[model samples]
Target: MKKLEDSAKRGRPDIVHFALMEALSTPLFLGNKMRVYVHTINDRIIAISDNLRIPKSYFRFEGLMMNLFRDRSVKSDEGTVLMELADGTFTDLLGSIGAGKVIGLSTAGVRSTAEKVAGISRDVENCAFVVGGFPRGHFAQSTTRLLGPVYSISNVGLEAHVVIARLVYECEKLLQEGVDHEGDKERGKIGA
Candidate 1:
């Protein structure tokens, strides 16, 4: 993988790892309020189920991904697919999820706040957000074409993990549940 340091071809699996750590453990994701998917540099999509816990270590995540690629999917002990892989473009992913609107977060896109974007999400059913997994540059032309509205959450370029953290926080705030399983006030996904 060191050889890919000089190449963009699968060069930043760690970026995806870190972003998953920020997202998968959040209340919004853990409470079945949201779903996550990774669109790789090679055009493969990995759909992550909310119940699956991501490894905090990069090496473990690397090993898990190796198995996932080899098997093309990961299943829980009870037989629920934890993570599933498929060959698809970004457009295909949005369509498969029945996304009403595909919003992209890119440094190259129009400027906006995370809350504003989350606010917009409440208006659209099954809204999806696209955050790049690479360390640098913008979304490819093909990916950008499928996005309904691209937004920049910062005045300066931000790392993918940062954008993911901020967006998740705002979404938790904007979409918090009125009552939880225990009938307590808990921040959660929109309409949960």
Candidate 2:
């Protein structure tokens, strides 16, 4: 929370708060265990990992997030506050996650077709999909360089929340269909 607030304060604006709430509330992300990383305006990254239950009510959420940002420690009625990574940049976060593929969501990137994007799930175990938190513009140069592929889910620019919801839903569906399992089986047969 502190990390989010600090990032929002530095220059990102309130868009970060809304994006965080939307992503946390989505069924794809809520039902599955996933980690969310917030890259603040000041180049600091805040990671929310493990069991994360964001508030449903906007007012309660705003208050809780604000409090967390200010105090750096606060109990939430909605969910447990897990670990936080401080003083880190987007690049640092990616590096710590190892050499996994990093996909950045961007307007100028390749269009996502059903056929081409379906393979996304196969890389889920070792990929990070990043959505910009700011209202406008592109990701920083440092962050862009770290990305393996940049994709635009919509022809027109969509809000951060919409992009995240759609991406997560598609990825989760592919995961449910056992894309990884099928690939592994094929690999074993080939090896044998």
| Candidate number with greatest TM-score | 1
lDDT of 1 at 10: 56
Give the total clashing residue pairs for model 2: 0
Worst ten-residue run, lDDT, model 1? 181-190
Per-model TM-score on C-alpha atoms: 0.86, 0.75
Predicted candidate 1 versus true structure: per-residue lDDT over 43-133, tens digit per residue: 7999998678998988889988998999999987899989999999877888899999999998878899998987788778999999988
C-alpha RMSD values across all candidates: 5.0, 5.6
- What C-alpha lDDT do the candidate models reach, one value each? 0.84, 0.68
Cα misplacement distance, residue 132 of candidate 2 (Å): 0.9
Model 2 residue 83 distance off true place after TM-score fit, in angstroms = 5.8
TM-score of 2: 0.75
Over 4 Å off, model 2: 1-13, 73-80, 83-85, 179-192
Residue 7 CA displacement from its true place in model 2, Å: 13
Q: How many residue pairs clash in each candidate?
A: 0, 0
Predicted model with the maximum lDDT: 1
